[model samples]
Target: MALLEVDHLSVTYTPRDQPANRAVHDVSFHLSEGEFVGLLGESGCGKSTLGNAVLRLLSPPAHITGGRVAFDGVDLTEADDEQLRKLRWVDLSTVFQSSMNSLNPVIRVQAQFADTFAAHKVPGDVTERATELLELVALDRRVLRAYPHELSGGMKQRVALALALALRPKLVLLDEPTTGLDVVVQRGILTRLAELRRELGFAVLFISHDLGTVLEMADRVMVMYGGEIVEDRPAAEMLREPRHPYTRGLLGSYADPRLPDVRVSYIPGRPPDLSRTHAGCLFTTRCPHAEDPCRTIHPDLLPDRGGLVRCLVAQENRLPVVTLGSAEAATVLGSHFPATGSLDRPADAADAAPVLTVERVSKRYTSRRGMRTNTVEAVRDASFALRPGRVTALVGQSGSGKSTLARLVTGVERPSSGEVRFTGEGGADVRVDRLRGRALRDYRRHVQMVFQDPFSALNPTRTIAYALSRPLANFAGLRGAAARERTAQLLESVGLSPAGQFLDKLPHQLSGGQRQRVVTARALAPEPRVLIADEPISMLDVSIRAEILELLGDLVRERRLAMLYITHDLLSARLLADEVLVLNQGTLVERGATREVIGSARDDYTRLLLDSIPNPFGKAAGQQTLPST
Candidate 1:
């Protein structure tokens, strides 16, 4: 018998003034004991909603309209408050998308764990249990004394994971558990989770937008689209032969950085709006092979090749198997979406003068605790040059000084030693470190940064127009109608077309991808010669990532701006960067052409980062063959 069964589940979000939106429509799935099943899809595709619904975690404005969530033979939808209280942590637990949000900021880590144990009336020494749990996630027991703010992102996630497993629940639901983590840290968390599962024998319902991670970890994979389960199959089978076109498109989107050459592509167009009912196939708009009948008749999920698939073409056994990046793949998979730019090293880039130069730059921080002074080196003698029309990728692990370098370059931090120089107007070398007041303000006009989190990077109280216009007025001395016109042009340049439509919209009104574009447009408002983008697309969906990467590349080529691309994703680096700089422990470990550095990495740290990347086609996939349709 299945450990958990979700039958005809439907979740709806009904606002008082707006129409009802069915986030999860008739979704059904089953997970056996000790099995790992992954729910994969783009953002807003209802994967997270379905996961939450199964646990009865949805609150006001969102409710499970219909469906039976049967866990261990108990119908969760019918469970009373008392029953749910006992079931939640004892039989089932969840790790949310953001660990910081899930953890209480005011409470110490030890107290938090103790509260859970005491609330459940577990008979044991809470501290001992907490220590064991932390150890299980590869964390030190001393972390118990620290607050959630004191821990790193990866550590917080591990703590959350430990809390979820405290009661030895039969099933655990992980919602985008490893999202936004560095590859090395992500791999470590996943590895530790796998080991814990093996030891405790708990089932996991892993939900994520990353296709590669799901394919690499999950035993069975279910592809979700338009609030429904479009396809469900073994991970290995899905990796080799995805029956649904949407599933195939997702597979094609992933490009292994270790490869000699890769051609990554995304399905054109965005997902369907769940606010309105659809008569035809949900994915028909995005599928390249969509036919006339697909426009009117909604396809049913039918058995196909040992799994269920909702596609008319696949049901008819007419869909061809084409290797990604081949001529046939382009023809069948709709390569109409422009390429993810190119990695072609520019001939003039080598001869171009340096726009910004860092000479023996180092950053240090001193913190005193209990009359003891400790100094830590964040960046150590880093030297590099940003040339016009070229992208130099700074790749490193989380605490390896990637962001510190960005701060030093953008003049946010003063280097303890050495200096940062930028070529000013009339070939004047400006020392970024000594700039004061007006000079500093003017220097900022020539350098701008696009932060990682677009939502936080933007002011929530402000409209898109205000966000862009402020920079225009401050840096370009444009206001009124001129500022408005320039804002539209910047929006259009970032691929948010019909810029007038987005001008009045608030940051909350736009999607993740759209918000990132707005953030990019605001950065370009100053018309800077150098662009520093720190993990620009790391928070976006895979499909949207291709779009953002393409936009960044186009901007660099069209404007001939020098760019510093800081990221932990090697695959994205391979897709966008011309040159690569590997940082390990605040030290430059490797620097070379993108292809050369990734294809033939010499530094141990560089090789580790590349190896940590989730490879769906690696040995873990095993020997599998695509069945003849």
Candidate 2:
């Protein structure tokens, strides 16, 4: 028997006075012993819902409406609450996305393992089991005495993994386990998990939004769209010949920074609304190959050459299956950039009059640790410039001081040493630290920022119109009807057309892409001369990412605005930046044109960052290339 089998499983969330939303619709799949299956999709495509349903962890308003989830022949849907509780952590377990928040903050790491063991009524020494599991994930026993806050993000995630395997469960479900981590950290976690899986012989269901990571770890790949599994195939086959249009779009949406001069594309429209019932294919709205049959008749999982696909066009052989490396893929490359020649490089922006300059800036923070105080150098002698109509990208790993430098540029924090200067009105160089009262306000109005998380950056309780109007009122002195009108105009500029439709909607009501667009619109409200975007699109979906990148490029070119595009992903830097600055350990290691630095790196640290990217077309799990940098 299969280790885990989900047969025609359906989950629905029924909100009060609203329509019932079928998040997971008739999804059927099975995991054999020790098999690794990757479930991938966009944010709202129900990847998490499916995983939750399998674990029998669905809360109120999110209950299984149909089908069965059988683990080793015992149906989870029919199991009692007490029975299900017993099965978890012993027979089945899960590692959630946010490891830091998932653990109890008030207790040490060791106590958490003891609580799990006590709850499951397992017969073993909790300390011994915890220590063994920690070693399994390559963590030291010293971590047991530390609190969650003391551990790094990667270390916390490893602790969570160790807890999940405390009882040697037959299967484990990982839901976006590596999200928000740096590439190097993400690679380490995945590598360790793969090794443990082989040694322990447990089936894994890895659900993630990152296609490249999924492609790297999964033995078999499944693409979920609008609550349905549209494609299922072996990992190698799926990467080679993706049959469904949605799968093809996902594979082409992201630009791999490690690969030089590669073209990226995105799906045209948004995903379908699950609250409303659809009689046809769930992806018809965004599928480029949708036809009459796709609009009226829903397709079923039909057998193909090496896997199963749920598309009428595929069954009819209307659209040819294209491989990622095929010649015909050039048409699907989407953008109008040249296919062969080297990508455009930024002009000598270093020689131009800089709009904003950071000269030998360094910031130090003194923190109290127990009885002693320690000084941390967040940024050290960092120097860079943002020139007119040019994008200067700041690339670095997490804790490499990219964010500290951003704060220094935006005047949120003062540098302990060195200077931050910007070209003020009337073309005079002004020191940012010396600005006072109204001068400081005016300085802030001209130097705006687009933060990383759009949801947190925006006010959740307030209307979209209110969020945009605040900046206009405070920065431009616009109020009442005038501010409202400008808000509508700003919304239209960001591609959220018919601004009236979204004016009164809350931030939570909008999609990830739309929320990010609103964030971009708010930053542009002041018509700032210099815009600093800190990882603006990293949290967004792959299909939504290209739109944001293209929007930034358009704004910079059309408005002739100087931009400091801060991101850890080199692919995004390559696509949006003119100049690239590499930061490592609070110091600037390399700075040059984006194409030149990425295409031919002279520094080992710079090369390490490039080599760390997970290649979708590369070898399978445990075979990924690694670098210590």
- Each model's TM-score, in the order given? 0.95, 0.95
Q: Give the per-residue lDDT digits (tens) of candidate 2, residues 532-604.
A: 9999998999777877887888778777788998888887788888889999989999999888899898999
Off by over 4 Å in 2: 122-125, 258-260, 325-350, 369-371, 620-629
RMSD (Å) per prediction: 3.2, 2.9
lDDT by residue (38-149, candidate 1, tens digit) is 9999989999989888988889799999989999999999999999999998989999879646799999999999999989998888899999999999999999999899
* Sliding window of 10 residues with minimal summed lDDT for model 2: 333-342
Q: Assess candidate 2 and give its lDDT.
A: 0.84
Per-residue error (Å), model 1, residue 267: 2.5
Candidate 2: count of backbone clashes, pairs at least 3 residues apart or interchain:
0
